[model samples]
Target: MGDTNIVGGIVKILETPEHKTFSANISVTKFRVQFPQFRNTSVVHLTFWGNLARYVADFYKINDYILIEGYISLRTKRISSKVISKSKKIEITVFKVYPLLLS
Candidate 1:
């Protein structure tokens, strides 16, 4: 097994018809874990893979609290802008996710 970077935060699962091929886009809102010098709320995007992918997608729901443990992956996707040109962005890929109790 490889060493994975863990990021924990609130779950924000996004589902779109186009993403039916693999799995729904999973995201974490207000991700506070970051570098020592950086203090900001960030969003983390996670892509489930293989058999475990379905489990994570099915079990987790929007607004659920979760702790994700996985390697940090950087992805660049093109986005359309109204007044600006094309843009590329980065995201995180989660391999493991666990639900946390509110209490």
Candidate 2:
């Protein structure tokens, strides 16, 4: 991966990994992480694909402090179903996961 970013934080949400077969089998996992910046909390959504997805689904849990190495991109999300408001969120396509501190 080029221009990869490394992020470290606590896992706030761990959604179940989705494993599906297309022409071939593929696995994807999504989760949220909360990191402290100054006095406030910042959150990021992480996407894990391939073999890492299976490893994460089996090993990681909430409150785990892990380092993510991947590419960062911004995405637009609807604030609410009834509202017209939209917000931009930072998302990372994780390539490698390091369980530096397990809780």
Give the Cα lDDT of each candidate: 0.48, 0.69
lDDT: worst 10-residue window of model 1: 28-37
Query: What TM-score does each of the candidates earn?
Result: 0.52, 0.71
Q: Write the per-residue lDDT of candidate 1 for residues 6-86, one digit (tens) a residue.
A: 554545443320123324454322222222223434445566565456565556554555666666655455446343335
Candidate 2: tens digits of C-alpha lDDT, residues 1-103: 6564565443444344343434666877787776644333567788888888878888888777677777788777765554435667889888888886776
C-alpha RMSD between model 2 and the true structure: 4.1
Worst 10-residue lDDT window, candidate 2? 13-22
Off by over 4 Å in 2: 1-23, 37-39, 79-86
Q: What is the C-alpha RMSD of each candidate to the true structure, in Å?
A: 7.3, 4.1
